[model samples]
Target: MINLNHLNYCYRSGVNVLHDITAEIEPGIHLLMGENGAGKTTLLHIMAGLRYPRTATECTIDDVSTSLRLPSVLSKVFLLTDDMVFPYPTIAEMERYHAPFYPNFDAALLAENLSEFGINPRDSINNFSLGTRKKAYLAYALALRTDILLLDEPANGLDIDSKTVLLRMLSRNITDNQTVIISTHTIWDFQNLFDGVLVLSQGRLVLAEKVWTIVKSLAFVNSLEPISNALYLTQNMGRFQAIVPNDGTLDTAIDYVLLYTALHSPQQSIITQTVKNAR
Candidate 1:
């Protein structure tokens, strides 16, 4: 588990990007959701020990303090950012130089993933398109098999077919010992892969809970009209989507987009309270 407490961060220009955030991230695929400039990337950097928190009572991964950036801790964590640049000319060259850093790196898995994405490891990476590059990097990242893998906007440059391949790879590749946190705006693409969610608003952590708990605590429904007692509601394509208290009788699949919208709306407290009471 990743343990954080009272974490705060500020840019060199004196702009605070994160504030007093504390949450435990368990092992699973968790969706990190927030609006633009919500400090998602900053938080990921801190977690990976690439950036230190300005002031934190405690911030550790598996009890190891991340601020120190020790080799022991760093070896088990990998952060794949949106704008990745490789000095190597090809995927094979990159892997040859970098794979040693990650003891668990699986060369076979990398080759398999590359094949699935229709990428040539020997081809110069500079010549590949943006989508192909992203796929290549994703394959390498997954093969690292790090204990903590943080992906920022992982699906940004993918086409429809590539996205489908990505979803399939993620579903089959992640192990129970691994904790993968994906920060993205395209929630619908990987909706089924999320085992939990971490939500940030402005600079604060508003919600951090398992998907099962949220599902048990609330009911997400679709109706012809808005439910008067709904904690939150939104209109979409002439139908109304709503979040209401689960009465132990309603079995509804969560509309993740609607749940995210509700958490950022005025009715956030009501929904949170309902979940807390259930727990």
Candidate 2:
């Protein structure tokens, strides 16, 4: 289990990005959704012990505590991001040089993913495209079999075929023993993949709940008429979308994309408010 209590973090400029965050992330596939600069990446780094938080914070894995002073507790956590920092090495060289750090790293699994993605270990890291490099890192991260996995926009720049493969891997690769926390704007890509959802907004943990629980409460539907009366409304290119609030009762089913559309549309927003106020 990855646990955080009153976690606060910021940069050197004294800008508080995350404020009083807390969560208990366990062995399950979880989605972390936020727009750009939502403090998701910073939170991941703090959890991974790559950076220290300025204020009072406590992050632990089971009984093992995490602090910037010791990276030992971090081996159970695998952090995958676009910037691999491979240091001008070939893929084979990278594996030989860096794979030892993660005790649970599976060399065989790495080779298999590399082969599946058409990334040769003998190929130089510089020779690969951004997508290929990301794939390699993803492959390596998965093979680590860590207790906690943190992926930051792992789907970016991936080709259609690779994306399909990546999706397949996540859906099939994860088991009950591991917890995967994916931080990305591409929440739609997850669709029915994630077991749970966590949304960060306004430097705060806006929402956290099991997908089954939340999906059962809220509903996202293609309304025949403009539905601006709901709590949130978004617009599409031409069609207006909205989420029918249920207040946690099983009165409606939700489609997330439709909810986003209704909430994002300006005309829908106003129309929704007017309708609600009238009723």
Candidate 3:
């Protein structure tokens, strides 16, 4: 498990990016949701030890302090940023040079992923388009089999088919021992894969709970008309989507987009209170 205790981070210009963020991320697929400039990338960097947090803060993966950036810790963690650049000309060269750092790197798995994504291993990475590069690097990241995998805006440049392939790869490859935290604005792309959800708003973590817990506390509904007693409501695709207190009745499918919208809307406090009361 990844344990974050009162984590705070500030840049050289003294602009605070993350504020008192504390969450125990268990071994599963967790969705990190936040708007632009909400510090999602910074939080991922801090967790991967690429960026340091303020003093008196604790960030650890399975009791190993990430701030130390020990080789042992580094080997177990992998961070795939949105704007990734490859040093090697080809994927094959990259594998030959960097795969050794990861003790559990799977070359066979990498080949499989590349084939699924229609990426040529021998082709120069620099020649590939943005979407192709993202696919190639994503294949490598998955094959690393790291204990902690952090991906930032992974689906940014993918087409519809590529997105489906990516989701299939993640669903099939993620092991129980691995903890994958994906920071993306496009929640609908991987809504079903989320075991837990973490929401960051204006540098603060406003919500951190398992998917099961959230569903139990609140019901996500779609109606032709607005819900009068909804904790949060919004119009979507000519229909009204709302979040109301669950009375242990029917099971409603989660509308992640609507849930995220509500969290950022003015009625956020009401929804938070309802969840808190249910908890």
Best by TM-score: 1
Q: Which is better, 1 or 3, measured by TM-score?
A: 1
Return the candidate ranking by lDDT, descending: 1, 3, 2
- lDDT of residue 144 for candidate 2: 81
Question: Which tens-of-lDDT digit does each residue in 55-84 have in candidate 1?
Answer: 433678988888889999899999999997
TM-score of 3: 0.96
- Candidate 2 at residue 210, lDDT? 68
Per-residue accuracy of model 2 over 145-189 as CA lDDT, tens digit each: 787899999999898899888888888778788889998776666
Candidate 1 lDDT: 0.90
TM-score to true structure, per model: 0.97, 0.84, 0.96
How good is model 1 by TM-score? 0.97
Write down the RMSD of all candidates, one decimal each: 1.2, 5.1, 1.4
Kindly indicate the candidate among 2 and 3 with the higher TM-score.
3
- Candidate 3 per-residue C-alpha lDDT over 1-279 given as tens digits, one digit per residue, 9 for 90 to 100: 888899988899989988888889998999999889999999999889988876524788878889989999899999999876778999999899999999999999999999999998999988988999999999999999999999999999999999999999999999998999999988889979988889999999988888887888899988898887788877878998889889878498777777788999998888777776766
Name the candidate that leads on lDDT. 1
**Model 3 Cα shift for residue 69 (angstroms):** 0.2
Q: Lowest-scoring 10 consecutive residues by lDDT in candidate 2? A: 270-279
Q: Which stretches of candidate 2 lie over 4 Å from their true place?
A: 55-57, 68-72, 227-229, 246-279
